[model samples]
Target: MPLPNILRYLHREQRFLAVFVVGAALVAGFVKLAGEMQEGDTQALDIAILKALRLPEDPSQLIGPSWLHSAATDLTALGGVTVLTLVSILAVAFLLLLGRFRQALFTAIATGGGAMLSTFLKGLFARPRPEVVPHLVEVTSMSFPSGHSLNSAIIYLTIAVMISRSFEDRKSRIFTITVAALLVLAIGCTRVILGVHFPSDVLGGWTLGAAWALGVGLLAATLQRKHKIEEPDGSIADQSSGPAPDQIGS
Candidate 1:
């Protein structure tokens, strides 16, 4: 689909849509810019930024008391597979309670779809990870599509949307989505901060992941509408919300 149509679909709220469109456009620009540049010094700006902000480089140091970093690490870590699986199960369970079997099934399909797209794009771009600084983390996958960034964003954001329709208060609905966004952002940055992914990789991951998630989400919503499924507006995050496919319909 054209970018304009995609933007229209995502534009449920003008302000948020503006941010998303702008972010995607800017990231796309940078991805292009990054593609043109040869191996150059990246550490100078980073060093200056780090010094100006007085942020610590060590994981332990970054995790002083916010506990969010620690949580983010757990979500983004390779060991996070178990967590992701568990979350997916929770999402399905919620769908089951809401009598949304179709969506429960969609969860699996959507995540796989996102992964496939990420792989395809990574191969298409063939972007290399930055070599200016030493890699503090280990990664073997193609670098253009950050797996960690895409997965978490798809999963968390999907849950957020599912819960949004059920809650009348709006705050309850918004909180779940807010946390989901935080998880996506935190995990993406963690990939960069850990020296495992280039900014472009994370950018591409979010763009591609959100696209897949949104497509699936629309499909799910369409199915729900056609079938007249009335799902309970329960808090999705409090339970086992996992992959976004669960959030697709009903």
Candidate 2:
């Protein structure tokens, strides 16, 4: 093989290895956190964090300005089912319009599958909602793993990964992913501040959600390498004289 080709192959393999290792580590961390929660080892820490977020005089009120509370409520809704579903639908429609059928299909699957997984985990644990503080928002589900945190992380991160592919520069890709991460962080924090979830619940959701997104990314990369999926916009295939796979149906 040519030296340049071999070097490219090595670089690709190294990237795949790094993603796999990070995904595996995230899964392991989630497992450990889950086990600790089951053993009641995280209760004290979770309770303390939840309580600290509330005012000493009134557990019902969050320790911030009135506007901050209102802002948190609105931000938290971004992670709700209604908003996420609408966002997912719009994203898939956009991808389809771009003739990226496989990308749209996978995005739907990733977000939908993540939601189902979140529900299943919540049911499996049957953890009660925090009673140490009054909840600012209404909730009526099990709470070992926060649904908002998990769903938002999965949806936003998956979308970010897909969108980043359209950018040619590393800085643009990093910025996109960073924005998604910040959104996820903000949503998770709001859940705690509103007294809807234990801190450990958000932590569990983040680990698992990130692992799921990484797993999907690995699959997408593998399929792209095998010529089974559309390559990114700026890939070598897009530079060729022939039409790209994603542009076939356009």
Best model number under TM-score: 2
* CA lDDT, every model vs. true structure: 0.58, 0.86
Cα deviation at 150, candidate 2, in Å, is 0.4
Worst 10 residues of 1 by lDDT: 234-243
TM per prediction: 0.62, 0.91
What TM-score, to 2 decimals, does candidate 1 have?
0.62
Model 2: per-residue Cα lDDT over 150-203, one tens digit each: 999899988888766556688998998899999999999999999999999999
- Candidate 1 clashing pairs, residues 3+ apart or interchain: 87-241, 87-242, 88-242, 90-240, 91-240, 91-241, 107-245, 107-246, 166-233
- Compute the lDDT of residue 67 as modeled in candidate 2: 91
**Candidate 2, residue 51: how far the Cα is off, in Å:** 1.1
